[model samples]
Target: MHIVVCMKQVPDSAQIRVHPVTNTIMRQGVPTIINPYDLFALEEAMRLRDRFGGEVTVLTMGPPMAEDSLRKALTFGADRAVLLTDRFFAGSDTLATSYALAGALAKIGEEFGKPSIVFTGKQTIDGDTAQVGPGIAKRLRLNQLTYVARIAELDLAAEEITVERRAEGGVQVLSTRLPVLVTMLEGTNEMRRGTLEDAFRAARTQVVTWSAADAGITDLTKCGLRGSPTIVKKVFAPSARAEKAHQIPTADLSFEALAEAVMGEIFARQPAIEGDLMRFSSGQ
Candidate 1:
């Protein structure tokens, strides 16, 4: 069995800043880290590989500096790391990113072994659109399972996988065949620390670098800004709200009485809420 894990190097959200004049992200001095959500996917992939006995390859598309992120993944026990970097891939939105990544995945399959499963995070912190994973699935015609909370079962011989998917209402248990793309949810599992030996190996390992042409991307028009249709009108920090939160007192009050007091305060603040509650209780 072979697994492919998609990772991204993103600016640390805590340190992110918006350019005042340009209204764009100020990434010049910002520190970069692996997308936090992708760590869950990476950990899950490593766990699956450990249990099933297979090689896990980590792949990323970014600038030359992004190679640092791939090396970090290697320290976490990834068998291989592939970096896809090209001048044509800059300023790519979700659509262009998925296009380039899909092509790279096909190239990886041909050069390496064909992967049985592809894993990605629910979303990246910088671009929280959560569209790339599904986009890849659509382009490649692979079965997609998004927001997967857990892998319930894997039957390799039968070529089936069962997963617990997180839904708005409840968890959905889904079963799919091989060659599926999964977007793993955050907080599903904790990432393991790399051993000293693993760190040494990662330092010595050569990360395979590929440009757009090397990744078998034929159409230059479908790669970067030209392929990205989405337009960002403005990017700015939200202004501070005028109204502050009202604090409720609970001193010397019983739980039920405190609850009633809170409800009274809410009703006083918004009479429509009380009317709605009354109508709801009366089934109107």
Candidate 2:
């Protein structure tokens, strides 16, 4: 069995800043980390590899710095890593990203065998949109399992898998086939530390880097910003509302008198509310 885990390098939210001129994220000098949620997905994939004795591949698409995340994934025992970076892939929305990633996965299948499974985080903190995984699945025609909490069973010989999935207000037990994509829930498992051997291997390892063309993509128009259906026409912070809550003054006589005075002022301001209160008391 082989598993592919999609990871992303993201700007640490604590250090995120917007560029004044272009109205874009100022990533320069901003600390970058693996998408927090993807760490769990990577860890889970590693755990599965440890159990079933298979290979785990870490895949990512971003700037050159994204190679760092792939190396870190190798430290966690992933057997291979691939980086998809190109100028043409810039400004890609979810749809375009999914297309690029799917193309890369296809290349991987031709080069190294088809991965039995693919894992992704539930959502990216920067985008906060959980559409890429499903989009990739649709393109690859792979079974998709989102918000998976656990891998209940796996029949490698039969190419079947069963998992526990979390849905709105409930848990769903789903069964699917191999070549599936699973979006892992956060905290499903903990990340592991790399041993000395793992660290050395990661440091010297060269991840397979490919441009959009090398990934078997020919149509330049159906990539990056051009392929994205949704566009952010503008980005601006929300303005704060002006005004403060009314302050209730205290009475000199006693605490109860002050409380009564506050309530009385509010009731006086809205007589209809007092009428509704009376009706509620009468059980009508």
- Give the number of the best model, judged by TM-score: 2
- Residue runs of model 2 more than 4 Å from their true location after superposition: 18-24, 244-284
TM-score, structure 2 vs. true: 0.86
Q: Which residue pairs show collisions in model 2?
A: none
Candidate 1 at residue 174, lDDT? 100
Can you write out model 1's per-residue Cα lDDT over 1-284, one digit (the tens) per residue? 88999999999999988877676788888999999999999999999999998989999999999999999999988889999999999989999999999999999999998888899999999889899999999998889999999999999999999999999999999999988999999999999998888899998999999999999999989989988988667667777699888878878999999999998898998999988988899995
In model 1, what lDDT does residue 75 have?
Answer: 96
* Local distance difference test scores for all models: 0.93, 0.90
For each candidate, give its TM-score against the true structure: 0.86, 0.86
Model 1 bad stretches (over 4 Å): 20-22, 239-284
lDDT of 1: 0.93
Model 2 clash count equals: 0
Error of 2 at 177 (Å): 1.0
